[model samples]
Target: MGDRKDVRPGVGAPAAEPGRVAYDHHWARDLHSSIRCSAAFLALLFAIDWGTGDLTWWRSALWLTLALLLFLVLCPPRVCAGEGWMASRALLRSRRVRTDLLVSVRTLDGVAQLLVLRDAVGGRVEIDPRVLVNNPDLWYRLDEDARKSAASGCLRSGTDTLRHFSERLERETALTVFRISGLDS
Candidate 1:
């Protein structure tokens, strides 16, 4: 498949009108705020101790603050929110759907998330296929496809309309399909 450009689905098909794709700023803001807040808090605590000339406070708070920062950095409140923005916009812009693909899978709260990148030029975007609709069978099917493709090493990723819609469908029906959260349509 890697040897053939036509291996991508809808290879010869005309591109569809682009969909309205936007990054979840709340997700990004939340991440940035968290990091900022953490750094501010640490600095404040350090100043408090230093000003008071309390070596004991510094020793205790330093370790505690460091530990908390470590935890925050390791497991940020929002998952891919940060990484998506971190991806290169220039690189993503050059990649059109069916021409270049992007895909990622991550498990959260025991639930596996299949994020299929739909567009990255304007901004990084990934649809959690599980969020589509409430069809457990379909979700399973997509999951199976991903797994099998991974196994065979023929997995292709893309940022385009088809991938966007597919992911949207999955996210919308996630709850109904998986008996989980009721998606916000």
Candidate 2:
């Protein structure tokens, strides 16, 4: 109902604690595009069903099911941040970890680069690299947390992987700078 919000740490909303923050797809225009696509599919189907001058129970059921499933699967999670902990929230579940306890950050090969983050306490999360590339502020928050983790004893390994991540970030940053300054094609 109106009392319940789709994502727990919704949008630009702050967390329960004063210093915490949350990020979700609400910030992206993709949310509207997704809804439009689903609606368009059902509308198209409805027009066809009406034009045929025939109505069937199965046809209605199929369209309803299709809309529900698309929204369910495409729904994005909210990434929440605290002083040392970060959490990802979905409609049905949530995952959290102590950012200061980070142990490794490696890129897994897939359709695109998948960054996997692991902590000393066995907390792990795999997310798209585009997430960071798209949101520099989010990347800054994570980078600060990782520095704290490295300073503490909780982070014991994965320097190489961390280095690679920073290198890539730096390369992208430099490219962005050049592009903005009209120095690069």
Candidate 3:
């Protein structure tokens, strides 16, 4: 990761690029966490079964199947900067302060989503497994107000947060937004 991109409030000064804003690998971290949780759950079930001395074949099969299912359900998918990853990579690259274009991506759950707010009408959109790739350094360098605005936007409008982040990035460098997963959290 490069140096943190400082987010100035409304000045729109294009500061020097903070080293290099490497892509963050958050999906792997989340997948690891999911695997660990699934394993722990399976272990707990096994331990309970062993302590109770109830090793029925059906129970064993059932527990194994359940654990497998849970892992499949919880594990984050292997993702990169693929086509399905972000909705507005092009928009992110070409536009600056364009509120007319927004990006929104759906999560694996299909309910919660991460959005990139280029402006009121347009921004970056995110979807499942890909949402796990949010970059922390890119996020941290943001000005306090921008962060707050994004966080609040996340709470209010899912797509609005994209603007704060995009704005932060635009303020820092001219490089395109790169998404990576599995970097140190």
Candidate 4:
């Protein structure tokens, strides 16, 4: 037992593809939440119409359409990162950026924080920072490529931002490990 090697994969481990890895760990949960929210809204509207005796076929159809719109608004994009690229796909469009060729990174402050990355190739992607916080594998791929960008003098801005973000990620990961090992107390 002492001589046995651990088979668990690490950050540097090769995925099925040589250096390609996609992160969608939270996609299913996000999709389910979107569906639940839309269904609940539709059910509430129908209940109110039925209770008031104002339900009609046209009204039902309108409610369904509204519910679908709500789902579209609530749905989160699927994010994936490979060796040199990251992509976010929504219902209508997909955005991708070359991580290794990144020229700029911008953080937009709003109700939800957005991280915008633009590459030398004119490809750009805007993603929620929480996605990186939740997915270490995705973060690792991006970080590895970003270092390359910096070393190659392609990255012109957001070096401090990436550094701070990486520190935060490290702290979060350490805390999670402590919590899991029952040593957080």
Candidate 5:
């Protein structure tokens, strides 16, 4: 993790050896939010039971279990990308795909938007597009590999999708810069 290099221009992220993996910069903050939410939920449950004089050992145990489940549900996977690969890791497992061998990229639209990438070797990973938009370093790694995939003729789908996504990222980046410079008004 410490060896990861970031190539995003104008950002103050530390540079390291090339070819090292890049990770989601916002992962820690999101993880902390998940923890806080689950803890607050547990506290509320306990407070309600105690206030009603219904708290018991068994019930406490149940509440704790519920809180743990809530945390698991709320937790977000950590996303990382290297020269030719991208991965998503959750509490229990990790999914990796060879970005340089990608065959398809699809955007699933529902309650939450998801970007699904499939590789020539049957590797697949579903990730949130916001992760890329928010972390330019990770996006850079993926974009570079996707280009390789395209050049090698392994990528058969989502060229237009990737182009549109790149445009969107550029727009968002510009907007953020404007906001940071107080020129967004």
Candidate 6:
């Protein structure tokens, strides 16, 4: 659907409580590796540029500016799923799609992989798959909504894509569970 409404799912979600899964108030997913790598790389550069000498204040300011800029540019989304829909809030905007009315689910591969969801009502959201992998509650909400959609004939297609996404998430979840149980092979 080409038409969409700027709507949020806060009121309709059960109890309007905080999300039980995939709720990242900060950068959405794990940024530890990225942050560490960036910081370490910057440190190395600073050290190389000013070895055994007092570093210039402007240079320190430059490093701080670089790190802050990197963080702001790479900031992730604020994703939450409600009773019937899911939303991914980015820096200045958010995207919400009705799961129960989902028309299709597909992935676009490029520099990054995005799982795209579309509804008959023209609502759409493109999110990172890791978002679902990290938050089971969001998956549950989407799965439940998709199930209801299928039953209602609102969602007549995209079963394959939906199943693929679901399976990937399930496999990851199982793997995490096994690892936690010390059952990794």
Per-candidate clashes, comma-separated: 19, 0, 23, 0, 0, 1
Instruction: Return the TM-score for each candidate structure.
Output: 0.30, 0.73, 0.42, 0.87, 0.88, 0.68
Q: Native-vs-model 6 lDDT?
A: 0.78
How displaced is residue 121 in candidate 4, in Å? 1.2
lDDT at residue 159 of model 2 (Cα atoms)? 66
lDDT per residue, candidate 3, 22-92, as tens digits?
A: 23467668778888988888889999999999978899888888888888777654322321122222211
| Clash list (residue pairs), candidate 6 | 1-122
lDDT of 6 by residue, 48-140 (tens): 668968678888888878876776566677788887788888776889998878887888999989989899889889988777877777778
Tens-digit per-residue lDDT, 76-177, candidate 2: 666656667777666788777777789877789977677778888888776666666666666666778888888886666766776777788889989999
Order of candidates by lDDT, top first?
Answer: 5, 4, 6, 2, 3, 1
Error of 6 at 59 (Å): 6.7
After aligning candidate 6 to the native by TM-score, how far in Å is the CA of 37 from where it should be? 4.4
Q: Largest TM-score belongs to which candidate?
A: 5
lDDT of 1 by residue, 10-113 (tens): 58765555432323334555456666776676677677777998758558667567847654653322222221122212211422222122243322233555
- In order, what lDDT does every prediction score? 0.43, 0.73, 0.47, 0.92, 0.94, 0.78
Residue 155 alpha-carbon offset, candidate 4, angstroms: 0.2
Comparing 1 and 5 by lDDT, which wins?
A: 5
* Pairs of residues clashing in candidate 2: none
List where candidate 5 sits over 4 angstroms from the true fold: 1-18
Candidate 2 weakest ten by summed lDDT: 5-14
lDDT of 5: 0.94
Show model 1 residue runs off by greater than 4 Å: 1-13, 54-185
